[model samples]
Target: MSLFAGMAMDEESVKAGKLQIANYKLGENVHLFGGAFYLCYQKGLINWLTDWNPDVLIMEANPRYIATPSAVKWMHARGRKVIGWGLGAPPSNSPHFLQKWGKRQRGVFLSQFDALISYSQRGADEYAALGFPREKIFVAHNSVAPAPTFQVSRPKFHEKPSIIFVGRLQARKRVNWLIRACAEMGSKPRLVIVGDGPEREKLELLANEIYPATEFVGAKHGAELTPYFAEADLFVLPGTGGLAVQEAMAHGLPVIVAKGDGTQDDLVRAGNGWQIPPEDYGALVQVTREALSDASRVGRMGEESLRIVTEEINIEKMVASFVRALNSLRY
Candidate 1:
């Protein structure tokens, strides 16, 4: 069969290192609910069952989605390969089910599908730790966008200090610590938070109360992020795993990324940015202070951010990995 190669499998993409584009789609959604699908399981199952016309059905990774035995069986009956993407490894709930399955049973269960895609080696490791063999589990990261071509050359940086945080204000994100860190500094640096979330009001209140210098610009996307990345002296994320790190780096902003964010475990390097020990709020504060102090280091590291993404983490590599994994599927 002819492949979907234009936008999906563009030749330019191959040059960028995209291994594969999904030729067939399936009964799954990834974004909503962190890997959840619509309700009405019985009706949804029937809808997916009758409409089964693809080779690969990527099941949503949440417990509700994978636990559907009938859903698994229906796709199998249709002569299709079922794969799971959008799965986070170490903390994934899949092993809870697979652990009870025996050695042969475990192999059979994991080996059945076309392939599983995860965001990082750590994520892939999460599955491997679960007894899911490496052959079956694939590390396919989210796409990394290209650096924008500004009409004007990016202006040189000033010695003025800045600290930026990008991500939701969710619990695990640990944004409050950042507000406090800003408070700790006698000559507090400008603490700018870019994303919006449930903690907005409270965090804003805390920032206002503790460190009035904090700037919560609410949520931002697209070109909106550029100014923040450009203006920032140092980028800081107290929480784990952020697309912003990639975005910030693309714009020549160096990062102070939190460790164990699953995705950051792959890219945090002394060459580019500092990996603040995860949950080490005091360390996060101290590191942010130090990062901003070295103006020259920040400039060099910012360039490194761009270099790292260009050389190692571009989107082409991601798409190609997907293609390679899918093509290798035993189906």
Candidate 2:
């Protein structure tokens, strides 16, 4: 099977897997009215498709892209199986027109695919609700490569708790909510922010004024991130994007994530962590205080988080699911 990716995939991923990938050179990344879209152009796509003649073609299902629809129809006409892979359906909070017309258009477009691969079960359900067949939709939980091995010594309840937030500091991320929530925790726990973006300077200013215990670590990757994950007693992302949630869980830290994008539904479970309503600063503060106040529960929850990442959602497991989906198409 061959996969067509709009962005550059890791060399290790291509070498380790049986599936071959063809990367496209992206053109302008148009952003309009708070929505970001990409334009992908592959000059050799048609020739490559003809020469390679892949049994199955898997493409991203982003509505913003123009190529996907045409490519899907082109592949379908040639009797090749096409799979739509992405976070299906826009979030419910999207513009009403998008929810109405956009969803209907997506539903029609997705129904043409032989199968659909969702980032989470919530996404699969959304696709089904939008008229895609339930049986044809597969849940391939989004994940990252396994986190580095680290030993976390459980802290006593009375010990000062360390809370970590890892992601780009952007407006939509609502890092300010986390800063405000941490300040409300009465400076008992140390709050570490481990990423930088447009909101960095402002967030730093807010942290200094409101939460003096907050530490801004700019951005760290690979082994550099190990110490933050290893030392933290709890992980919190009060906004969207929970890829870091899985990474924290893999490092044996329980997460407190906001409900957004439906990706967190698969990763954050009852035993593992809490999922508060989006943008609820009061609830975030209360949850953080309670979780930090009881270290024993946090430790147990951390163990559940570790178990879920190791057993259910990791890079290996995700790739295996993709392989299975591709294999199913052949038979």
Best by lDDT: 2
Alpha-carbon deviation at 247 in model 1, angstroms? 1.1
Instruction: Estimate, for each residue in 1-331, the C-alpha lDDT of model 2 and write its tens digit.
Output: 3433433333212222233454433333233343344444544456557666776788777666656667777798888898889886855566898678767787777777888899988889889999888878888888877633555555543257788999877777788998888777764688899997778999988988988779998888767898888778899999876568888898888999999878888889889999999868888889888887777888899988988888888888788878878877887
**What is the C-alpha local distance difference test score of candidate 1?**
0.66
Model 2 lDDT, residue 321, Cα: 77
**What is the Cα-based lDDT of residue 166 in candidate 2?**
91
Q: Give the lowest summed-lDDT range of ten residues in model 2.
A: 8-17
Top of the candidates by TM-score: 2
**CA shift of 36, model 2, Å:** 11
